[model samples]
Target: MTHNTDLPDVVPIFPLPGALLLPRARLPLHLFEPRYLAMLDDALKTPQRLIGMIQPNKVPGRSGSGLHTIGCVGRVTQFSETEGGRYMITLAGVSRFRLIEEVEGFTPYRRARVSWAGFERDQGPEEGDTAFDRGAFLQTLSQYFDSQDLQTDWDSLKEADDELLINSLSMLLGFEPEDKQALLEAPCLSTRRETLMTLIEFAMRGGDGEGMLQ
Candidate 1:
């Protein structure tokens, strides 16, 4: 799709820990806070309705938390204004970027000049990037789900491609913030798959199956 520009030079940043949005993946967000609500309002008027999802330097409750340098940029694909004057929207991941610096903006939310130079592959079409190890993922999934008393469609799992499988699970699961960040910052899809397997295995072993993504 041709855009106003080939790439967005700057984007509004959303610092929500544990929210992982990979390229082509979708993330739904609720905007109630004044800062983020305002950010959404401004983004709607821009050429590219893009928002950068990143983790905080420190978890919100912890001290010294600012924002992470690496994040995935997403475009607003779905939106709705709630009766309570809130916004419910979904973002479709566009590409990953590295934050250079935060720029002062009128919006209450923070803005950053980010670089997408190294992630050229993310913008273009996805190839059969990597061979998905369905058996391994299912084996671990079975154990975790069974232990958690969760039921899912085996057929759907079988049909989902590697990217969808990994990103879907990553977003759906209640992994810890750090673990989620690790999966998001994974160098490639293959690496994310491997990290996912490791996480699942850990969750499976942790008693009662509510693996707290250590």
Candidate 2:
């Protein structure tokens, strides 16, 4: 496990909208673009093998250079190369970071200097959600999944711990980019769970009062 101090002050960033990586979560990426491939190559050479996963802000009039201030950093825990010259890698989330500024560089991909302050909890043990209502949450999730025509391993989800279940859902769900960013920026497990439930309920309602809950 990498501590906050062990993380670098600057890291190559991957600005992917609608992609949320939470602490202790794993995000698998398929990198084919030449710039990202180069970024991966450079990252693999470093000791930490870290990459900042940030989202490009889509707010009106700020789409060009605006990015959400917060992002999660992950370590390259698994890697493989495909015959098509693409790279498949699994990044194990280390901690969430605050983007300080974009570093001026000649690299093909973007890089940023980040601060890990106020996020020390990200490197600690898994958080417990005492307020979590698994049965009710699952009921709502089941309805949401059914509405979206999504399928998953129910048994696996049932066995997962509270943090895993909520964070996984927060990351993997097809929510809007801003909603996903909200989940990522949640201060704690319980807060994230609450945000996730609200998002699910809103989705079930079709974002308005039109659709009936399944």
Candidate 3:
């Protein structure tokens, strides 16, 4: 793992579409793409099984085929070997990075020179939405879960800290791709929480009152 320094020696990158990972959160990924499989193998061999998760600008073989500028670097915390030699791994997010430049590499996966200078500032609880009531949020989540018939281990849920609870909820909920990205890019925890509340409200509304005529 790279220390909390301005510059680092090596930066490992993992680019995918519509996937967002935030700091202090966990993301589980299944390796199937040949290029990414190679990337995962290379990462596992190294000390910092660290990968920068960026969104691809366009689909492969399409006109615009590149990735976005900013992404988070996650380190492999747990991994499992599957029957087909595929990997089931969980990444714990560390910090965000700004893409500096792409380097030529042997594998198909993209490699980039990145810098952490941009993300060193405050990513604290959001302003204006500072009046967050955790108790109310939990009660609301319980009601929402009941309505959806979703079962959770209440003891664990009750024990989760503010950051973990909010990030986990935002990640698992069935939000639109754009919306999910928005939540991932939110600058602070309060903003994320506020965005989640809006999402929860929308879900409660059910299809925005416009379903198929059938």
Candidate 4:
């Protein structure tokens, strides 16, 4: 993990909604769009090979839209260019950063000046045995998964520690963008666990107008 002190003044980002990558988590991307393919190409040339995963407020004009401010910065740990003009890459998250401002650059993809000051703690591993309500979280998650008819490995789920289990479910579950953003912005693991539980219950009750839960 790169120290917040060592993070660059600016980093290129891919403003994709409904797509999220959290610190210490891994996100695999299919770079098929021309602009994003170009972004991937440029990222691989640098030693850091980093990209910020963030949600955009609205449609981007030439200048792009308002970003949600906080995002996870990850390094391109794997890359492969397909013969069909596509790129496959895996980003291993390093730290979260706040978008300070946009940088006017010549690159095809957008660039942002970011500040990692408050998110310095994201560099290390998640705390062990957090005060989060693990039992309730897993139980609700099991109910939600069963409702969705999604198979699960109960033994493997038990092996996941607090941070891994919480963040993994947060990312993998199909929650509304607002719900996802809430989980991302939660101040700590305990809060995030509680938020996840609430969101699941809401979905189960058909709060989103859909009979099924996300």
Q: Can you write out model 4's per-residue Cα lDDT over 1-214, one digit (the tens) per residue?
A: 5777778889989988767788888888888988888888888888888998987764355223477787888999988888898888999888888888899978888999989887766787675545766677678888888877888788888888888888888888887665677777777777777887888888777677232222
Question: Over the stretch 52-145, how does candidate 2's per-residue lDDT look in tens digits?
Answer: 9999886756434588889999999999999899999999999999998889989999999899999999999999999899999999999999
Which whole-number lDDT from 0 to 100 does residue 86 have in model 2?
97
| TM-score of each model, in listed order | 0.88, 0.94, 0.79, 0.90
Q: Each candidate's lDDT (Cα)? A: 0.81, 0.91, 0.72, 0.79
How would you order the candidates by lDDT, starting with the best? 2, 1, 4, 3
What does candidate 1's lDDT look like per residue over 88-119, in tens digits?
99999888888888888677899888888778
Model 3 C-alpha lDDT per residue in residues 1-214, reported as the tens digit of each score: 3455633545667876557788767899998777878888888888678877877654354223376667888888998878787888898877777777888877778878887765653233313335779788878888778777899988888887777778888778766655666676677788889888877776776754221110
For every model shown, the clashing-pair count is 1, 0, 0, 0
lDDT, candidate 4, at 66: 76
Which rank order by TM-score, best down to worst?
2, 4, 1, 3
Q: How big is the positional error of residue 90 in model 2, measured in Å on the Cα after superposition?
A: 0.5
Best by lDDT: 2
